[model samples]
Target: MTDEFAPTRFSHVKAGENGWRSDGLRDFFLYRDLGVAEATEGKVICHLVKANMAPEKGTGWHRHEAHFQIVIMTKGWARFMYGDQDTLVSAGDCVHQRPGIVHYLYDYSPDMEYLEIVSPADFKTVEMPAPAEVPPFTPWS
Candidate 1:
């Protein structure tokens, strides 16, 4: 019997030529949206999202339909807003999100870098919910 070999899904993504990819912000923001490699149908899909958010530039309110998110702060600080709950996660902190739950981030500092791991990769690719416009710099007050 011969063993079959399967290739790994990912490799390190280098930063842009300028050493930073602008996210239309002054500071710097970049990400790698791992598509189908992390999408495991009928069971769980994982999105290995590594994001570097500029100061005061963060994501909007969005919710998952049949997926859950496990957000981990690997670099700086970020405030995660889930409905009426305000959670501040720094490096080494982890946040879990349930399906149908609305959430977003704000008050991200210049040193903010985080990773979002989504499970059941059931995120809506076409009709993704847009994040609500919340007052910037006031996610956790």
Candidate 2:
């Protein structure tokens, strides 16, 4: 039997090695690449995301085209909706987003930050109709 998978290498990303960039999926947030994509040969991606601006309008209803994905809240908190179910992800919280699950991130704190890991490095996010109304975001003082 032949192995169908390419070998992956060890990767280490030190803090301050990569600066956060605004060219992420959302303009209201910044992303810091953790060097996992290159090391894994595009098989996966790991990154840290943090709020860049106040949440006037959060990430609208959308879903990602990924086989596996998870968001681990590292700081602050965020409120998300998974098909009409309101979920508040606080610091140290982790959420596994099932593939093709329609969701919305409607609110978050000023210091909200999370680590996101997804398979297949490159993923497509498709916008979808809102399942329910979103709540107002807390004003940042």
Candidate 3:
């Protein structure tokens, strides 16, 4: 298995190269792969994630089963509950979410979009209880 990804090659995904698709991550977000998963043979996955639906209810508290994970806010802003701290990640912000840190993305702008990269492409997500009750979402229009 390791031999297959021994020499991870390169990939060039140009603008509008890959179309968006709905996986099982979030019902309101659409993702476009950047060919990192195939290039690295499931070692890493890089993709652009965009909010496609309104923020009626954001992603509930959940933790990813990954060794490394990061989100770089490229457009707009998003409110997230990281552990017990409520953070607003805006454009130009990069967040390195340590593995197993419970978080809830509760609100975001219509143009909210970010680049998310994670290790072990086929990582798992385990739903957990929220650390604290989340406040009402602020209007995002």
Candidate 4:
């Protein structure tokens, strides 16, 4: 009997192999696909995201419809509001965003970059209302 699910294949994405593209979820950030989704046959997705421009208006309040999601900051820092609490995520920090939790990334440094991993590869993001007031962003000189 053949199994309904196909086996996931191994994947190796060398540095500089795939170019960063601006056609991601946010226009202000660039995304570099790491080939994890393809290798896993849509079971998961891993990608690197970097700032494309200075902070003006950050990502509006939104929630991702995903079973599992995490962000690992690789450089710089960012400010986010998860529910009513404001949290700062910096380099070397990791944040696991619980499924359906309302959050918003309100500010970030110019060099901010992070590795994001999510399940199901193709997740949905729904806009949400702000839970509280967001702090002002630091202006880049």
> Model 1: per-residue lDDT, tens digit, 52-123?
544454555666665666778877777777776777889888887776777766666556666666655445
| Candidate 3, pairs of clashing residues | none
- Winner on lDDT (1 vs 4): 4
Off by over 4 Å in 4: 1-6
CA RMSD of each candidate after superposition: 6.5, 1.6, 2.3, 1.8
Give the residue spans of candidate 3 off by over 4 A: 1-5
The candidate with the higher TM-score, 3 or 4, is: 4
TM-score of each: 0.57, 0.94, 0.93, 0.95
What residue runs in model 2 are displaced by over 4 Å at the alpha carbon? 1-5
lDDT of 3 by residue, 1-141 (tens): 487657698889998898999874887999999999999888999999998888877898899999999999999999999988999999999999999999999999899999999998999999899798887787755
Let me know the TM-score candidate 1 reaches against the reference structure.
Answer: 0.57
User: In model 1, where is the ten-residue run with the lowest total lDDT?
Assistant: 17-26
Q: Is candidate 1 or candidate 2 better by TM-score?
A: 2
Candidate 4 yields a Cα-based lDDT of 0.94
Q: Could you tell me which 10 consecutive residues in candidate 3 have the lowest summed lDDT?
A: 1-10
State the lDDT at 10 in candidate 2: 84
Comparing 2 with 3 on TM-score, the higher-scoring candidate is 2
lDDT of 4 by residue, 1-141 (tens): 346555687899999898999999999999999999999889899999999988888998999989999999999999999999999999999999999999989899999999999998999999998889889989888
CA-lDDT, candidates in order: 0.56, 0.93, 0.91, 0.94
Candidate 1, residue 29: the lDDT equals 55
Off by over 4 Å in 1: 1-28, 33-57, 125-141
